[model samples]
Target chain A: MKKISTPYHHGNLRQALLEIAVKLIRERGADALTIREVARRAGVTHTAPYRHFKDKASLLAAVAREGFEMMVKETKDQFSRTTQDALARLKVCGIAYIEFAIHNPARYRVMFGTGRPHGKNSALRKASEASFGLLLECIKECQKEGTVRPGEPMEMALAAWSIVHGFSMLFIDNQIREKGLFAADRESMMDVVVDHLYAGFKPN
Target chain B: MKKISTPYHHGNLRQALLEIAVKLIRERGADALTIREVARRAGVTHTAPYRHFKDKASLLAAVAREGFEMMVKETKDQFSRTTQDALARLKVCGIAYIEFAIHNPARYRVMFGTGRPHGKNSALRKASEASFGLLLECIKECQKEGTVRPGEPMEMALAAWSIVHGFSMLFIDNQIREKGLFAADRESMMDVVVDHLYAGFKPN
Candidate 1:
């Protein structure tokens, strides 16, 4: 392997490596991706990336954190649109979440489902909380407006979140097959899952 | 690397490799696993596995199918101890499923979370269905006994499966954080998750 020395200018090598790393990971499963391959693909010396990331795990964390930051941004963008009521905002948020997963399945999966230990990454942790915080606020709004059933606000948020997140996972994984796959009825099924959560929380 | 062309006279190289693969994957993340690594670890020639599996994907499929079979067996075993009531049986199965995950988080993650397709392996697909079939049957029993709400059996099953499976995923992923680093009151949380599912499906 010919080693190309690092360029005189860093010229965004860290971001460049992160981009290539994710692309390689998305095309091939993580098992097949490595820092050497990423460096090779990025036209940098293998050691060049080491300065930015001590190891592959650090690079993975960087990618995951970036993905999470984007998730927070996605939520904020959805919340920017005005809705007549809390229930409507809740629905849009749900749609937005699923849409985000569908668009960036691999990145989103790596962000949440990769089973990596991210406890050390405070910014990443805060980013995840920020997204969930939006959901919590919406749930509170729905509860106050009498559209959502009253419960511990956190409980309501977690429960509703489990439904939407679980559904999104199932949909992305295509786990719903042999009867769960309805005809072009994505919105209908989303409504049903959301409504199930709604029914459980509805003012009784 | 010296190629040990000596093939085993008896016993199962494939099975041996799989057993090693599972434990190694669990201890370290899946990214480090490889056919050559398994081969070297198992003391078999690199070519020895080719006789058993066409490639890494086939070996992984074998591993996944084994995981699903284990899932089915454990679920059935859980239901065998107690009186056979639909809801009760289902709850036990859920517990068993979570136990399998906690006990075998790596295998469980690969079983469902891996993005690689399980491919055109009928046995693998059938085993996956067989594992899920146990849940569907229990849900039907609930309906028959008038405990389950009126709805499509599969839809209900999907909901219940999502709730428990999602809970299990969160638990297995160790994503649930307890305040103050206290031991998580997982039993209470799991109970509530299932309780919500049961409540959502009670006959109106």
Candidate 2:
């Protein structure tokens, strides 16, 4: 095969490869992606992708890392813009997390999918930790402000994460809309769900 | 290829096919499953599987339906055996759900995986509804018994479902233990998580 070296060789080849790999994942499900195919799409030599991604799993790890970083960025953006109290602000972050999943379903799957990079990738693992860490920090603030009940911050954060993550998965799978389970306006439904998360339904 | 006649032909062929399909799915990921392969493994002619399942999607649909049915059975088993109240009963069901996911991760994945059977399968859809219906029924009872705060039963049930489902996904994906997010004993951890789910930490 004739080698076609494009401007990507001169300009940030690693970033270019990740961009194309993400595009491929979005277009086709992750199951069919290959490093050779990513290189072909990037207009580089078949071997060029190897310079950045040793194999398909590493390439996917890079995509997952990018996904976590993007999620943290979106959550932080919401935190900065919102003026609500700690618990309420945490709700805003949850909304941001769900919105991120809604806008990027394919990438969202890769971030949490079973095939995600395991113990081998520290960068990917750190990115994953950072995303969850944002929620942990918010819960700590909520407890400190007396808005949330006192408990281990990590456990409470996991509880909060469960609701948003579950809702996002169900929504992306078309389970929510197709089943007509919660037909109320989407934003209001999330608000109500968050309220449930804040105040569990146990009668006072 | 010569067709091998087996007792499954005279017995319950459909059940046999489903069993074989489940085994294949467990052994190999769902992506590689095919009707012909299943039939071949079942000691039947390639076209034999077509009699029960029209295509690969249909075969997958049957698998998903079985998963839902099995889940309902497991939940009901706990209900009959436990003496807990409505809200507590629901927690038992939730624990059963998480346990099912932990033990049968592959089947659990297929029950909720995106590529699962869609509009074409009514049996599959109803089976899926029945599983959620159990949770909704529990929430309705919880409301009646004054254990849960009054709200739209579906919405409350969904909140309950989201937490359990999200936890299951995270656990099966190795996110929970791998990160040491919940280091306590498994059952006690679930109990605390369920409590957080029941009584959200909002200060009175």
Candidate 3:
């Protein structure tokens, strides 16, 4: 395979380092990542990464931020392909969230795993908030259509998020596989899970 | 502080090593664990841990098994204290699960984290199944009492597990804290989250 190389310009170098870091995380595990290793993989001088990342944690935060952005885009794309019915759109978005994690298990782990940067203004935190904002918007739409029960939108959003996030974590962590649950038809199992969640949102 | 030391007898050594392993994971992280380190911490010879555990992974499996056993006990204790109303008992058990994770975050992480042993007869796997069995029993009782909607018990149980597990992961992983989603009172927030799940299980 031909080695992928990036030009040494400041902008290209930073983006190149981030790309290499993600690739390394995917190929190996997050523990395999390092500035020197990413720089080597990017075919840049060892010190080149220093200009872009202050430390390993900072690099990880960047990777997590990228993961969040990709998740938001994928979920929105999936939701957009569905009908205008808020409930249907919510279901599409929820499944998309799980699919994103299942397809990109390593990135998903880093996105939610411990040790990434955390603060009000941190890049990763902001990216996560943006992704969650998409879910909140979907819930609001459901409420507007009188499909979902009216309540504090944040609480409802968190309830929706917990179920999907929990399912994804169990799937990614192999808990679902280990227990021999949903082995034959995962898509159907997802429908059952989503349907249960949708039932909770209906006005009682 | 007095260091807790164990006798070097073969039987005591194995149990001692497991306890020390849990302690090390709590203080540092799972990656910090090793047979040699656990043995040293247990005040045993370097080769002693090898007698019980063939490798680090095996040691981790033992730790995870212990975590599951403790979780089962904790959930059962909590359930026994609640009224016979299946729904009420289920709520108590669910809260116990989250409380167990919060109080023993490292052990909880190891219990569900990737790369541990997984097989039909593996000790860790059996322990996990047993823990999940308790939840299934609660759901069954709910169905018998005509509280929860009648359906496939397994599906309802999985749905319930997903929500609580997701909430615990989010709380433990600091996702809730980072997003500033629930700052004032987490206990009440948990009630809201669990209430949404309970609503789903009600008959239409």
Total clashes in model 3, counting residue pairs 3 or more apart in sequence or in different chains: 0
Better of 1 and 3 by DockQ: 3
lDDT of each: 0.74, 0.78, 0.80
Candidate achieving the largest lDDT = 3
Model 1: how far residue A46 lies from native, Å: 4.0
Colliding residue pairs in candidate 2: A149-B201, A200-B200
Off by over 4 Å in 2: A1-13, A28-40, A44-48, A115-117, A201-204, B1-17, B24-55, B115-117, B200-204
Tell me which residue pairs clash in candidate 1: A149-A201
Say which candidate scores most in DockQ.
Answer: 3
lDDT by residue (B71-176, candidate 1, tens digit) is: 9998887787867678898788677776787788788877777775555677877888887789889889888988877777766666666666666676666555
Across all models, the iRMS values in order are 2.5, 2.8, 2.1
User: Poorest 10 consecutive residues of model 3 chain A by lDDT?
Assistant: A2-11
In model 1, the Cα lDDT at residue B3 comes to 46
lDDT, candidate 3, A1-204, per-residue tens: 743464435447788788888788888776666778888877778987878788677777788889999999988887768757988888887898888988988888778764323664377788888988988998999899999999988888888899998888887777887777855477877788878888888985
Among all candidates shown, the one with the greatest TM-score:
3
Please provide, for model 1 over A100-134, each residue's C-alpha lDDT reduced to its tens digit, 9 standing for 90 to 100: 77677677777756676567777667767777788
* Candidate 2 lDDT score at position A149: 68
Give lDDT tens digits, candidate 2, residues B1-204: 645554444456778888888887777766556788877877788888778778776777788889989999998999999887887787887899888887887778778774322665789889888888898888888878887777788887777788888888877777777778757777776776677777752234
